[model samples]
Target chain A: MVERRMPSIRTTRFSALAPLALVAALLLGAPMLRGIGAVQAADGGNTIESVAIDTPDQVRITFRGEFPAAQATAENFRFAEAAAPDAPMALKSVKAEGRVVTLTATQALHPTERYKLEVADPPISRDVTPSPWATLVTLFLSSALINNFVFTRYLGLCIFFGVSKKRDAAVGMGVTFTAVMIFTAMTSWAVDTFALQPLHLGFLQVLVFIGTVAAVVQFLDTMLRKTHPALHRSFGVYLMLITTNCIILAVPLLNAQGKVSMLEALVLALGSGLGFALALFLMSCAREKMELARVPKAFEGLPIAFALAGLFALAFMGFSGLDFFR
Target chain B: MSETTERPPGALQLLFNGIVSENPVFRLALSLCPAVAVTTTVANGFILGVAVLAVQVLSSLTVAIARGVIHPRVRIPVYTIIIAVWVSAIDMALAAFVPALYAQVGLYIKLIVAFAIIISRLEVFASRQPLVPSFWDAVGMGLGFMIALMVIGALREVLGAGSFFGIVLFKTKPLLFFALPAGGFFSIALLMAFFNALERKLTGGTAKPAAGGHHG
Candidate 1:
């Protein structure tokens, strides 16, 4: 009876996390999914009505209804060549008006080779509203890996380099950073949604966001010093440093700029914080090992560390330009 | 920034120090994040460089003029507010006048508020100094930043994209790796190492462990 009950509990836990696992699996499949044919529209009415090759460099796509211009940017369309399916066509410009989107390639499309056009986003943008879960998951994963703040975007290097020298410090700083990032992101989102946006004071975004982050960091510093003295001692100074941290500032600014929902904002913050933490941890481990190795005089400390980061950035590049959800 | 005498250094000396000895990117290692992010292209880097220069000068001027009134306890916040104001003005100007360049660097323009270089200069130099010296220091630091970024941007663009300031140089990219985000790291690392070697050669001093590590 105990064994049977244990299996039942395990299965229940698995079911609870099933969506998250599915999202990861889908994210991993993005590169492969890029080569696959167009995802059939949920509502057949919204499917591509016609695709005409107007010129060597231009492909005109028409939809059933007025294709929202917002949904017709270059990123929404993917083009593949028959000769080299893996190589995406380089688009010079994309113009959308009424029901038409005209894509102009940088070079003339080969007259002989067949080509495939996939409208990766617009159909969903128009017809099937992305569920909140999907939006949240996409933002989270994209921020964490595909568009990693530290590796790809290069935000927060001062703390990233300063604390990542030691494993223990890295872990401590990473935790403090994530907690602070989430709290700050939440506060900024609230201020943005309630105070700033309604007032038509968009110009105040930089001032307000920085002020909010600074206020939050100060509040956290005091609160931690009192409540968690041990933890404060470990990473207390880092709290003050968090004010000028590009990552800390970037998250709230990004959230405001994107006009993301609150939950989506939270997920973005969590993801970016985790991504930065991951970068720090990996660099610390590598740096710790490098301390023992022989090094040239010029590339002793930061130079070698940056070299290591360059390699890591190369590895992270695999995640770029991936389409997570069809 | 330690002064040997009670008197401040001359303007030329200050400018020389910023451009060579205490270059923000290669020497001080301040604001490395934004430096690398915007240096992907010469044009982008130049635009950001100009923006940073303007902010640094404006903020420094503001801080120096108002330093007498600003309390020591709240100087950091005051400096920040001043920086944010200048950055927002630049951001708005770029968006209004040069919308194309603004589109590329709009996010980074807003990000200048948090840059360690501008804030550090304000704290270390501007807040303590008189208006003229502060102005010169800001220019020196700003010029150093701009030059460093332009150098990195030119190298990256030439190597990565086979272009210099959007003018195609090579028929094909010399090394596509130089254009990617990874390439940004490598470019800075290589240039930093090279600068270190050059400095050591010129100064006849013992090799110094990376100064970039001290920031943030």
Candidate 2:
């Protein structure tokens, strides 16, 4: 009786929880690579928060903290392409307005190309620029990264831990979860905006969001069963299960206060979905590797998987200092 | 035939059951995410546990009282609606009165709508039992869950931060891993084993394995 037995981890059943937080970090970080210059600006009060390329000729840099406008020299900020580092874009003039630094490029930038705006490590001053677009965009963008349900909020844990045993299944479940999230997010936003807000029945959000999710899942289930039986048989269980995933419910609830616009809701859902999928894939791959190793009897099954998730979260913490543009 | 009929446990027994025998975290292995996420600190875990326990008791009582009227065919939805109502009410109140606590556990409170533990009790016991019995059942289960969470939280806080309930216990450097989510996993596992060992020493043996994993 004292001898321990390992809970089976090889069953292609499902991942236990979502890990796409890194995937979210990556997806959100994609925009960062384009501004790889700001990505490298570590969190020592020297970080750059926002950069605007209104015209390729002139770019505006906004700092989250204080940066002296007078100290802004031409060499302080170097612009680059695809972040090749070797090939730097020459600047025509450097102008600083408190925390806002405006750089005029010597050459016109390709409109389609993503530019990497590098800032040298120094005390960055908080310059205020009124780019409503940047502020709105980053607010929406960071939710996908910092506010992600799985990594940050720890939602969708049951599915993440259960279904992540197989990479393909995890990917499938993640995609289905993301699709449901986008639709549910949009529908919930509409309901909150039109019905709940005017009536002051904000407390009904949990019921409203859960109802929306359940109704969506049931509708999708019926439509799939009738229209595409084969596909339904393949992924229908996953579709139905998304209704129970906390991440999906959490998304709408977080946006229930009408703090984010409808577009931001959609973006956050998509980013969160992708992040969840990424975490699932990473976890499945790692769990698959566990098959070859001998695990202790006591720490087998959910225990070890959770331990791994903790490690995954810690690793994601490496990106803690990384903010939207910074 | 006479030996097969088991005597049902009393109200206190039901509550005691949640603490050890059928601990939602350690034994039943249900609703683990909140257990892991909120256990980073003792205060965090206790607050979440309180929220969940309150929701569970109210929802269970409601379910027990409404059991006869709910259609079996659509029972799942009805139960869901009941739980969601209670959870939402708590969610709103927390945000309004205890903004700081709400800021920390609001997501968890909202997410309680999806917890298998609360819904499972409604389905398994409350729906079939009398109102008084169901209420006791839920209270027992709630206390069990709260106790389990606090035990995990206290352990994590002490080992991770070298403190207990925010008080420093020693001068040693704390183990950082205990504070991380991984620490949550490890702490839960070891604690499960420890709890099981203690349970065995007391009661003869009816222990389910540690992390009696139940999939959604």
Candidate 3:
């Protein structure tokens, strides 16, 4: 009887095709370069006009084609008193046309005072609304606490789980992660808004964002390693992990999509990072206690940790009803 | 009776291990991030479940076949690269073919790369096992993950949205938090408590009593 040989053709074909597939990906990815170029061109020369309103009451303002019509209905659109910079007057009513918008105010206008009309991006369909400086302050506070990134949005779970095993490490990692998130968000916003948007490079958003995060994390790691040895030891592992943390990646993309101003972007990044840190701190404390507790064989490590996280998440839900910032 | 006379466990054993005995989410508690994040709606859960299943199976196969050739020092990076490539391919494919689901899942489609479950399996079972056993193990674990996600998603959707898979099952006010981040926590906690209870009941007092510390 002749010895039968099994067909090795499938395995051979798979091995042969793998390199070809990679080559094809590279070739197809070439369009990404042109796309990025388009994004850059579009965002580079985009000019924004900041109009200071001196009126204390609501003012009806209209715009023409120069503004993206979507800005007429932005949620962050507000009127502030020129005399009292802290008390922002809300827009009573707003109406918009192809290029013009009419704003009506409920309060009286103060003569020769400098008030600002601000608009946040998501609620707005257009990009032309003049966002107020106060909106930036609010965004910072809200993003950092009320609408925190990690505790609320649950981004960066992997790093939160791994490095947060100890309280001190968690605090250090949280602060470092927040700092990295802010830096990464700022760079990504600049790149996306200035370089990519004008060039129609939206398709490269994910690739670019991931690359930016990885580079930022690596740079931060190198800097920390050289500057503060003890601090570096505490955050070194978590710093490397931040490369893949989604909050760092997600915030910049969200900023671009939301079309927020530079100030607004910074505030949002700070808030998100702070929120992440807060969540990590709480989780670490809980997990530390869990370490000493007697756990069943089946529910020892990851399982119990997850269950605890779930409860913490539920506790954080109470903030949703506090519509102070919304 | 010699111990060597006992028969080794079969493929069915491997399959059962993944589905129930060693279920990824509830039992092993692996892949909790995606399990919790995507379980807001039934559709999201189903889509995520499929993504996890595909990544787990393909990555397991690759890791098992190349286990001996790859150096242990570089194993993590290699595994991550493999998973990232597959995840990106899935993300693009979804963007092209299933645009609606892609939009709903959004950036999370790319997050599949970071899910610990896929990497954990690669490190634990797939690396040491043969291709056939690894394949069955992946299927079992994948199914286990799918079931857990679907359960959580269904519960959340029904309670939070007052619907299941977008269909209004009853005319009632929804618990909005059930759809938000908080609901993600509450639902998972309750599910875990239920799992603990089930584990105790199934083992018929054979398993050791869970220590108080483990009770989340």
Candidate of highest TM-score:
1
lDDT tens readout by residue for model 3, A139-230 = 65467656666566566765776767888778767767767888999989998988889999776666667677777778888887787555
List the candidates ranked by DockQ, beginning with the highest. Answer: 1, 2, 3
Per-residue lDDT of B1-216 in model 1, one digit per residue for the tens? 243246777899889988878999888888888778888889999999999999999999999899889998998889889999999999999899889988988888899998889989999998788888889899999999999999999999998888999999979637888878889998988999898888788878575755755453
**Better candidate number, 1 or 2, judged by DockQ:** 1
Q: Tell me the native contact fraction for each prediction.
A: 0.74, 0.51, 0.18
DockQ of 2: 0.49
Instruction: For candidate 1, write residues A1-326 as lDDT tens digits.
Output: 56545653554345335534654775565434322222244566566665545435776766778878887788888777755556778888999899878899887753223565667764432211223444555677789889998899988888888888898778667767887999999999999999999999999999999899999999999997898565566678767667778889889889988899888899899889878877888999999999999988788777888888999999999988654443
Against the true structure, candidate 1 reaches a TM-score of 0.77
DockQ for the candidates, in order: 0.52, 0.49, 0.17
- Order of quality (lDDT): 1, 2, 3
Q: What are the runs in model 1 whose C-alpha is more than 4 Å off? A: A1-127, A321-324, B1-5, B205-207, B214-216
lDDT of 1 at A289: 94
User: Which CAPRI category fits model 3?
Assistant: incorrect
> Candidate 2: which stretches are off by over 4 Å?
A1-148, B1-8, B171-176, B196-208, B211-216
